[model samples]
Target: MEVTTLTRVYRYDGIDLPVPPHLAGDPSALRAYHATLYPAILNAEAVDLGVSNGALVTEYRRAVGTKGR
Candidate 1:
């Protein structure tokens, strides 16, 4: 038998950030948590990237129309 631990990652503002253990498994909470770190994320959208390399991945995308404003 083999056991493996999965990690969580957040991809926002073109940067890959390691997700805090407490925020794992809760997408909305994770996003709000990230917003504290990156205020701009408050206006962004969360996009799940599923799992990759044994880690859960998510991306935050800002509104396209608000780019230049």
Candidate 2:
């Protein structure tokens, strides 16, 4: 069987907060703003959470920067 792994990171206040392995596969990991704690990059204002993908975190910062909130 092929092995697949996903690391969930929460980027909060310029820090990378890694999600515990136990919560890695949580179904509520992704959701719209105010729907869940997990913050999708597109919904930067929705949460103060981080993401595993560095690129996504960059994008989130850019988006937030433009908003200046």
Candidate 3:
């Protein structure tokens, strides 16, 4: 018998992360959603870079604060 290993990816399907109807075309809601998603993005980047969560969080907060202002 032969064994083969399968590669894995942590990709998220959109179905599990649906956007709210009210937020679809609203700029403010879009901004808020972007701000909220920044942290997750940072975390993913941190994992890729093998960095600390603090740095990613700092960057996320900075970006969110500036853009969400």
Candidate 4:
């Protein structure tokens, strides 16, 4: 009998995130789906990154205010 080990690392914002086996393979479908729903994806990612929807909206408003200033 023989045994082997495998490891993979994925990072987002300098932090590691887990990848499911299916997504670890081909990501074309995932890419296409994200492209088609980018706005929703952005909101979800913001939430995942610890920023609530209201917080993100506030941040965007602050950015725009700074740009105008």
Top-lDDT candidate index = 1
Q: Candidate 4 at residue 60, lDDT?
A: 10
Query: How good is model 3 by TM-score?
Result: 0.26
Better of 2 and 4 by TM-score: 2
Clashing pairs in 1: none
State the lDDT at 33 in candidate 4: 42
lDDT of 3 by residue, 1-69 (tens): 986543211222221223466775563454456546543443222112222432211122122233333
Arrange candidates, best TM-score first.
1, 2, 4, 3
The numbered model that scores best in TM-score is 1
User: Whose TM-score is higher: candidate 1's or candidate 3's?
Assistant: 1
Tell me the spans in candidate 2 whose CA falls farther than 4 Å from its real position: 1-6, 27-69
**Every candidate's lDDT:** 0.82, 0.42, 0.35, 0.36
**Cα error, candidate 2, residue 20 (Å):** 0.8
TM-score on alpha carbons, each prediction? 0.68, 0.31, 0.26, 0.30
- Full-model lDDT, candidate 2: 0.42
List clash counts for every candidate, in order.
0, 2, 0, 0
* Poorly placed runs, candidate 1 (over 4 Å): 1-5, 66-69
